[model samples]
Target: MPLFRAEHGGAKARPRRRRTRNMEWVGSCGKTDENGHVLSLTRLCLLSLANNMKDMWAKDYADNYLDHYSFRYIMGPFTLLPGELVEELTWLLCTRKQMSRAALHLMLVPQLRGLSLESCPSLVTATLCAHIAARCRGLRSLDLSGGQQLPSKVLCETLCCLPALRSLSLAGTPCDRGVIKAIAQRCPLLRHLDISRCHLLSPAALLPLGAPLPPLPLISLLALDIGFGEQEGDPAAAAAYLLLSLPGLERVAMEGLGQACCLIQQRQFNRSDGFTDREGVPRLVELWRDWRHRQGTDTCRTMREAAAREEEEEERTLSDGFGSDSEEEARRDGGPNCSQNQTEDRKRGGDLSDDGCLVLQLKDVKGISCDFLDSLSLACPNISSISVHVDDFENTRGESQGSLLATGLQAWSAQLRSLSMYHPGPLVNLLPALQVACSSLVSLTLEGVKIGPHTPLLEVIKACPGLRDLLISAEPPTTPWEAEDEEDQRAEQNLPRLANLCSLTLNFSYEHSQMKPVMSCMSLEKVLKCLLAGSPLLEKLSLVSLPCPLNGILQEVLDLLHLHQYFFADSTNSPLMPLGRVQRVNLLRTDVTMMTVRSLMQRSKRLKYVDVSYCWRISQVEWMHCERSTEVQVVWL
Candidate 1:
């Protein structure tokens, strides 16, 4: 039954046997099937050819291939290749920079539905756009995000041509009002649009689309990110208008709208009747009122339409001999029932509880008062993530308004999942509020919060038991008189077990010499051990700018790793296990040594990335040895 018999006779037989062994070895190298092997070979050959050929030669070769393939496919009965395959091939060429303008024109097939020339900045030209417009008519999604060189006119014209585009990202592009207008006018079916960082395009440009008019163009849009773009106009008003207009919008990112908060604060103070006193404030107030009225009107209209449809359906059911006498009587006597329905509809319309927007990003927007936040939450009650920067907690009367801010936070705390606050001022007044309000938080990031003797960081962490990610950048104490009595008292207490914590970043900045004495009182080493022991799921541990003895902590981690390995080697399970899941260790500017680093690498098999940049203790020879010895990525700069 054997197809071939092995023979060990002479040199010729030896050579044949070697060839057979080599063939077997090659076949055992990979587990891919025949088609996968063919595809891999094709890709490798194409990449090799592209790498060897010059730009012009590559373009010529691409043109020739497209010509031959299109001619044969159009003339013969052979089915064309799948669109995804063609798109992948194009993406490969683009990523390698082998896709020239001429090649791009030749490769714009009619079957292509999604194209991302994000990496090919040189090919994002007017002529190329014209080619795409002419050939790729069925393209649904396009990402020209980093095409800052593309002119607004050309972009507008291109977008106008592609009316069928559903998703488009022009982030970091020099898009202007005309281009946005073109999108509203032409691309009516757009569901996702990201124009973030388009500095030339102001928020005023979006007003027309969100205008209180019949047949809103971008009504079907689900996500819109215009963050860090415009700062000249009333961004808050524009944001509110968009939220009110777009009923289906789920995410809105409007970072760096600090000017809007400033304008709102100014308007709040200048509420006099004189025209000179209240120039722009009344307009914004009226706009708010109009938005509220419009929301109520829309809700009432929807309810009325539903009631009318129900009445019609009931009449039809009676005609079809499927309705009872009571239903027929209720339909005929519609005065009291109609009155009750109208009252219920009115009550529902009056309630400002919008559940449309789920994510709202307002990073670095200062002067956000409690009233503004309360009103915003009233309009968007289902917001889950928000980023804000509280510059000063004082009101216009020079009084601390911490309670007011807390009120605003409480309004939306029920649904808040992620909260990032950058408070340059002291958080003594706000920490208590956050402890109570943010118990439901899953991710908490606090930057620029001064950590003093009274600031209980542990208590805040304990409040949010479900936190999966926590980042705390603590500033040094402002006064040297503030002792570490509070921290010392809590040194013996154990941190609450964070069962879900996965990432933690603790940055304690000590710029002055006086703060060094204060830092000694805070038992950071004990705190670190407690946190590590609690967070068994911790994968990323970043200790930046900490003036503590990090080497001891590293040794503890190494010992834990040894214990974990010992238990595994013995094939037994222990009740207390090590942090065996840690994958990323960032000890930037820490005092950890090479011994700890080497032992860590040898013990933790799952360790992937280690950053020891600016670590003075790590010398050149040791850094090089560690980098060469381990497969783990080691960074030493």
Candidate 2:
């Protein structure tokens, strides 16, 4: 009989006691506290031993530890940790200078899914890639960007092994045409590929993908970044071929395509072949044009056949006495005719070959003309993000091309959600068009643009109600008085409240020299206060090279936080308080004091990153105090 008896109470029952295992509690405590400390200490000891192994005693000790104790005892606790933690530990170990061949072999486990050895010149060798290919067969993402030492042959062979790879970034690697062909032939399941800055890769490297008879097409590829790569042949023809062939591509970064597009357009308009004898440009252009025409013809033929079949089906239905007389009369009177529908479908399908492309990156591209932009718009009707350098358009050709560039931007403004422009060559003429057409813009970046009375930064903010991320790198005005006057005028105007704004960066650093005086309409305390007050949801605030002192700005933010708390004390509806969501504050090269840093840390509860590099006022002692007070990472150098 048990004390805890059944509900019927048939008999007396004994009470059930909870079981407490001392071993489980001891194991949890050891793994949580002692194991981490012991492992870190052992890793430090091992690194020291590896460095001093030239001595007789150190060599003996290291050999003994590696042979008898390292894997059996030191690595036993890692099994209890999660796979992600293990992978991160492996990456850290591999990046260290003390990492040897034996250590690398130990880290390459079977459960590894993602590995990034980016810019690790010492670790990214052909043998390392071979070892990864052999061990990490289940890997999904691999980033070996800037691995200049990795040989192309080994890379190709390594890619052939990892068929499960979904993302692969080989930027700045010396991959050639053969490697590109191998990737297209083997890795069909790849979704994102980045081969940017691969100077050895020619334009012909992508031609194999568009070939009629291929191993297979990269049908699952969604994003391709081939930007900044120096090509041997005609890049425009290759890009056109790719767009026509791969209708599944959603984002493409062709940073140097502006010059190539202009070249193609110029050649066509002038009926000249400037590059006919060089690099087989004429042959590739002809091939692309022919393929495009064939695609349109095939689409039209297919649509007509489908329409004919539909008409036949309707006539058969009428003959079977299932249709009314009114229906017959309407069909005869050309109401919703099948031919019209077919024609419309054919026109739409023929015009847009790469309608799936949503993002295009053309940074540092020059010579963008109107016809090329129109053609691009027709091909990719849904481009939402674009990064371009406007100075190229103004400085390379003339002012007319800049106007053409502005017109192209206007054409795309209706669909653009993110726009980034560098250098202020003709932004004065471009801003008005943007104000009217860019109502749907969610992110805008203007770098090296002069923001004065002419630019009117407030007007741009007001125009885009949905803007969430804004970055302005304004060059300093010629005189300090002008900047002060502009700031005063701006502070007088009613600041627009940006409820949806999450990130804001205002950089007033002169491009050539950092010691120069800060000059901008945004280099004042009142203007910053108004901006911060308007952005209630701001998470990241970066003020680089500003003239205004950090204490005043931080004080304003602290006051706002206190005011928000007081007002919302009794209200339970608001989940986020003002300035509470500020996670990152970058004050690079600005005049920030240690007191301001401490104040910001005390007020902003969720602040995680504080960058005070090049800040002259904060002493080491004060920095140590701020660092020891909280877990927030303070970057100072």
Candidate 3:
């Protein structure tokens, strides 16, 4: 364990002594003179020296004793010494361990602003709370999470005394409604409150214990995180009460209150009948019945049919070795022509002028409508990136007409540089809309979404020319065998030129267990070489949990540059791998060997970090072969 050093920045703690009339009063504290200014200095010294510093001192005196006379005579001479010349004092040791009543009294000071006594089970007595409330009057933040449980009265008194607190964290503590009411009544300036694991407190106990008076204003909280307890009782009511109490709150994070969040937003946005129900119960049952009457059990059948038609059209255009009319129509609608317009776009330098970004993470997408995005765009016009994460993508949908693709295209497309959607529901209109609108996109991450599952992933790559980072954590389509004597036509197709690509992460980890093993159908060797052909500036690559032999993966990548030279012999001047700037490679949970790792390191001089963890067959001795290479750090399982 590391030793705790209370000295700030390796400097010894000095007894601050000012040269004034107060100095003499502080210095002459223990001297037993005829003026009665001293109280038996020799006897006090003998008593202090002989005793083991037991808890005999008054709590008030012990907590504020540093401002008194005893410590003045003990360490006042060290105040004249320079910082570098001061010797280390072994008697004064301070740590975060549980503080006895005497210890806490001695440590309390007016200058202290922050205190973290987390998980100190020994310091849970009511006396400690009373001492802190009396002495540490200037504290602004306190973290007593996971500490010893306190009685409701002591907890109430402790919180009520700290009216100047700006932040208070009491997670995993025992408290009742009375203590919470005391805090609400006293700490009117409190901005953040976290009562996450207070299991004894229910929604009924959290109903804004104090109302705003004429002179005193209501507390304007910036954030409140209250969830994850055994007795949440009625989360919707609690959330509603918090919102009604703190109307100006900016963020509210609740772990087990997703349904409540959705309900709150739905009521706030869709106020047709003012969302009035008899017992505050929602109209979800009525809405479900209405939806079932409108649409049959096959809810997603329309979406599937639309996607199948689009896929057949895309495949027909690819098979004929020509572009479709829809592709030209998309270009006319503002799509960037990857092969022809990239040179001019490169000259212009793709950089977003705005720096602001908006992030939204949702557990349910039932209440998110296109009007919501429109309102957000109007409110925050300079938002440069919009990231969306949905918990259950396959079933998430809006109860409105405009689809998710329409929102992406019509709202802030010219300013967006990064678009990340995890577990998307459907993509029949997404690619076409993106190609027509978000041309300046620099980073795209689509995890657990099927893109070109019937066509090819190369088409999706070619649609965006300015992409710098691409992470596709989804499986592609298996090449279809047309005839017994023929092969899949897509096996030999070339990839689009993405000259600005820098980082790529393709994780097919779910395929090993979810789908049948069919590595031969992917034609991965040809596909990989095609994908890496124009991305010469690539720096980081992660092929995590791929169920394939990793023996020739690096060799195939290294040979791609030479193949590019052969295929495009017209130019013939581009350098080998052009940038050759690959610095990190993560092949975690793959079948990679040490020999393959060494070969990759030998090829890329700038390779710095490689994670080949969980390749159990590789020997420890083989790990030593690359240990001497200073540029690379081999991560092991």
What are the RMSDs of all candidates, in order? 12.2, 12.0, 21.8
TM-score of 1: 0.68
Q: Is candidate 2 or candidate 3 better by lDDT?
A: 2
lDDT, candidate 1, 1-637, per-residue tens? 0012223452342222211112122232343331234235544534444564445434454545533432211211101434555566678778766766545554566667788888887567666676677667778988887787788998988888798888888887888878877877777777777777677766556654554334243422322344332333345555544544554555566532333333333444133223212222234455445554665576567766777788999989988999998998878775244346546645665433332222223321222334356555544456576666666557776645466557667866677788877777675766766875678888888888886556666677677889999898877654543224666657655557677888999986754433222334235665577677678778888987675677887788668767776766752454434465678889877788989888877765567889998777898899998888887889997
For model 2, give the 10-residue run with minimal summed lDDT. Answer: 26-35
Candidate 1 clashes between residue pairs 3 or more apart in a chain or in different chains = none
Ranking by TM-score: 2, 1, 3
The residue pairs that clash in candidate 2, if any, are 1-13, 2-13, 2-14, 3-13, 3-14
Query: What's model 2's overall lDDT?
Result: 0.61
By lDDT, is 1 or 3 better? 1
Worst 10 residues of 3 by lDDT: 85-94
What local lDDT does model 2 show for residue 65? Answer: 49
Query: Each candidate's TM vs. the true structure?
Result: 0.68, 0.71, 0.45
Clashes of 2: 5
